[model samples]
Target: MAVAPSFKLPNVGPGPDPLSLSALAADNEFVLLLLQRDYHCGNCRKQVQVFADWYDEFHERNTEVVSIVPEPRERVRSWQEEYDLPYPLCADPEAAAGEEYDQPVRFGPLGRFSDLLGRMPKAVLLDCRDGDPTICYTHEGSSTWDRPELEEVFDAIDEQR
Candidate 1:
């Protein structure tokens, strides 16, 4: 089992600024970390919206959804204006957190240079009650559109419970 990596980034959403992995874990039973492909990813936008629509349900289960975009804080701020997401939307311009969690990148060197060209989406569910946050489930996308369903995430959390 993989242990979840710790990170702290500026939040551009309806939540706190400078959100940290440890704090998120401490506050919730589970943390659903959504790693986006890039700033303009349509699928990423849709996925966040879906999670926003189902935010209440997730909260009822003591799970917090956090969407991370590997773009500048300003770029991520635009999303907050457009989507108005209810959860934490973090900005990780350097992609340090994404790299920490091993978010997949294709196209070799070119992909590393440009996130839009190579980065793929990823979903990580962390069990946070324990002292150390542990990765309970992960869906690594082979393509930009390849992401797990909301129910699938819920089921994963339920199984662990």
Candidate 2:
């Protein structure tokens, strides 16, 4: 299942306000993965690297894959540089996008019992064609690194083309 929500946030590198999702969709089909800062887990870094690898291959086919991290611009840039990610890594510090996707930003063990209920890692794929965008897939929780399912997501995107 995919989540397609309307947003009017600032764009990267000074372009326009209320960025048009329709325009972006018309330009290219995209897969957006939302990530949170996990200071205690090295796996988050690896997860991003995996996405980067997929982005490289997908871009060649004219598919846009972007990862949005809920961090400040400087921090996001540092990670992008460190990982050598070739795609855009936008800053979504407030996790507004994540909430829009209906991911379990909250309701986890730590989140349910504490005040940190609104910070969780999740992924959402968007198939932006001539019409309104549609969500192609979604994954939330800890076992995001699991295979087969991940491969299935790529396959689904490929099938759309």
Show the colliding residue pairs in model 2.
2-135
Q: Write the per-residue lDDT of candidate 2 for residues 5-116, one digit (tens) a residue.
A: 8664433422233345565677776645544443223555677677667765677556665565655566666776677766556666665666676655455677534324
The sequence of per-residue lDDT tens digits that candidate 1 reaches over residues 92-144 is 99999999999999999999999999999999999988868999999999998
Q: Score each candidate by Cα lDDT.
A: 0.93, 0.59
Model 1: lDDT equals 0.93
Residue pairs with clashing backbones, model 1: none
CA shift of 101, model 1, Å:
0.2
- In model 2, how large is the Cα lDDT of residue 125? 67
The runs of at least 3 residues in candidate 1 whose Cα sits more than 4 Å from the true structure, single-residue gaps closed, are none
Candidate 1 TM-score over all chains jointly: 0.97
* Per-model TM values vs. the true structure: 0.97, 0.73
In model 2, what is the error at residue 4, expressed in angstroms?
Answer: 0.7
Best-performing candidate as measured by TM-score: 1
